[model samples]
Target: MSLHSVFERLAARPWLAAFVFGAASALALPPVYALPVLLLTIPGLLTLLGRAKGWRQAAWIGAWFGFGHQLVGLYWVTHAILTDVAKWFWLVPLAAPGLALPMGLYSILPALVAWRLAPGWPRVLGFAGAWVLAELLRGWAFTGFPWNLMGTAWAFAPLPMQPAALIGAFGLSFFTILLAGLPLLGARRAFGTGGAILAVWMGYGAWRLQGLPPQGTGAQLVLVQGNVRQDLKWDPSHRAAIFQRYVALTSQGAAAAVAEHPEAPVLVVWPETASPFLLAQDPEAIRIATEALPPRGLLLAGTVRAEWGPDGRANALANSLVVLDADGQRHGLYDKSYLVPFGEFMPFGGLLPIRLAAGGMDFSAGPGPSTLPLPGGLPAPGPLICYEVIFPGEVVGAERPGWLLNVTNDAWFGNSAGPYQHLASARMRAVEEGLPMVRAAQTGISAVFDRAGREVARLGLGETGVLRAELPAAGPPTLFGRWGRWIPGGILILSLAVALLLGWRRPSQV
Candidate 1:
């Protein structure tokens, strides 16, 4: 079929268009062709838009499309259900549609923008700009989810996406949308714009890739992946089992590191909540963790810490990243500043139907951005736990660290796409800051990412293993890293302004 005829046929069934578009968007996830998926998002969106009978019709269609996109794209949320028996069955029906419905609202803004701005000649421009604006809203609105963004599809590829350093993940996302929308203009014209843009993006990435050099002799790091079950992770009955699993994994990593790189001391990392019991409160557990570490090595792991305030209630329950020296001495502690909603801290406390489910206690937020000091007094490492990695510009702030360390417990998600999606976000952060990242997950997908966000080594999801890799030293600071989210903010504002200006001028002249 001719391209135009194919578009006409797809546009005939609005519901089919929405479903197909939504499914195509999921290809933006990893282990699939990610960069090309950007090309699909635009056409998928345009087909849905073209099928709409009117503005109100378009809104409803867009909402359904958005819902489908988020529903399938984020189906990994089912892992939350697997965590608690009471919540598992209940969340299966509730969380997926409920989260999708609200998230779909963000998609509506882009549909409305495209419907209203309706650009000619370069239809992709309007669609790309509108979609990016929608994505920006998704990232900022309601404390932001920013998961499964189009840019993340390129997580495994650095050559085309290195531009992320200059514009942040959102900028790369915007360009992805623009490229995706281009095919709507046809092979000749669309290819011209797409090819040129792709060339420029690749060229810039190449320059940045070659120009930057490792700042120091890289550190040999061991990421421990203990395949602990979510149901048993925090169960008091299974606490000993969980502890044993982590210790075994850590010992394994240490042994591997010693055999491979005896000169460089190994830095072993365990995922968030690897130890369910509070280390500060449980002296024995702390001692066990200390004794587990090799004399010349360091251990960085996640645990929960509590402090009783004057209010009598447990005033502070923090999801913390704790560092232990080679002798297992406590070197530094970074409490997670950004806690997950409902999962970590209950929103509005008791008012919401979804109670604070995970972490047993009502978690309190941590203090300002602090970097954990490495052993040799090298550059500090920025630490983020679980949901903290999802926030794009916020995590790696003013003080650019040598590498980003993310410790997560994907056991909550089980064997779903959720873990893969989560890993994609972590990789995007590597690109955003132009810093290497070492992710240690409790369940699996433990991997290492270079400054450009390329996955050098990875252990598959649901696999219990340890990966010992060299952590790339710091390179010249990234543009986004140095200046923060200002660049992406500028692009967002400018795109919206141009869309608005064009929109205003159209009616008066007509």
Candidate 2:
């Protein structure tokens, strides 16, 4: 009869309540940061898990929750499929749900763990541990698609994102879910504890910012966004025009950047595959590209690299980045290692009889991660292409580079949350590694982040422009950068230990 009773009845229905709450939780992430909504959604999901009679029901509830969350979060995938509707008409409707299917399975482990634990703090803590554990697993399972990690909810602000410098993003997700769950128990002590932790998180950020490193005296960056339409990007007739647009933007931007910082060498960066012709093979294209560079400027542009066999015929292709100088010489080359399944290369050996990528041949994966040495005494960079920037603790190699470079073609997803979310992930990587991130993207969202994850400059989505800014100096390696996955791994162990020990001591009925 009462409002509480009505809400309780709805929450009692695990299938619908879990799905709705999960969908609502995504609003807390970027583009639309509705954080207060989490107070209801997280607590509501915990209540449903606590009420489950068995693991089967709990798992189903979690599956439904994950389905709803991913279905909404990744709806932009449909946009990629819609780019060629005539060829992939039916796929447009299925893209989001299809990707959500496997992603939803990851929720089952956390649900089962939470169901097995006693109610109250034990269940909440255990659920948080299990949730992050699932996240860790999904990050690497089946070639990995670690998009929209729960920690990114805090990515809307730099204050909450500071902890990532110590514990990394996965560790932040652990704390995030743990804090989100405390309210469900309705205890003042738990509430006070969560408040205290939140205060510490914010205080740490303020403290870190106070000692922020000044901008570096290295080469200034000019990020060129051509805003090329996805449909026309690969058209043979438009190839020359697309190439000219980037060259023109580069010349204009480089000149302005040099004028502002005459002492700094300029680095003109283009987005992934910005070059219409094969920059590695075409001497003429490389010469034309170099013409846009300032007297001391260098160009870093993404292009397709061809791998030749012993017989002198091209055997494989690699999505790659190349750095060039005024003399039309290639200084550094880095290929993208992590290829997107179905998008870059077909799975199951192309038995599915469909290809999402442009070319007929599958792209070859590059060796994992490497630091690129630049010319003219510029700081070496760790290059990550496209979604490769989304992975936490995996951005750099043993040889730490002075900065991070991410080149992406977000045009495929159009003007959607996909690019925004991608940018958020890149920002987190900068915070985690204590290195500035220079991100150049096709069709905007081009920006630069300092070592502390502060935005120095940004170009919004759907805009064609160049962002000119100086590179920020890299700080001493953060705790997360030094320890890598071990920090989150330890936290995961401690969280599970707390859950198990407490659940054993205080047994409660479901």
Backbone clash count, each prediction separately: 2, 0
Off by over 4 Å in 2: 1-6, 309-313, 504-510
What's the lDDT of the predicted structure labeled candidate 2?
0.88
Candidate 1, residues 239-353: lDDT per residue as tens digits?
8887887888778778777777777766888889788777645667878876766777888888888888798667778888888875556888888877678788677765775
Q: Could you give candidate 2's per-residue lDDT for residues 136-244 as a string of tens digits?
A: 9989888888898888887877778889999888988888888888887787956797889889999999898778855775678999999998889899999999999
In candidate 1, the residue pairs with backbone N, CA or C atoms under 3 Å apart (3 or more residues apart, or in different chains) clash, namely 39-180, 81-88
lDDT of 1: 0.75
List the candidates' TM-scores in order.
Answer: 0.91, 0.97
Q: Root-mean-square deviation of each candidate, in angstroms? A: 2.8, 1.8
What does candidate 2 score on TM?
Answer: 0.97
Local distance difference test, per candidate?
A: 0.75, 0.88
Question: In model 2, what lDDT does residue 342 have?
Answer: 83
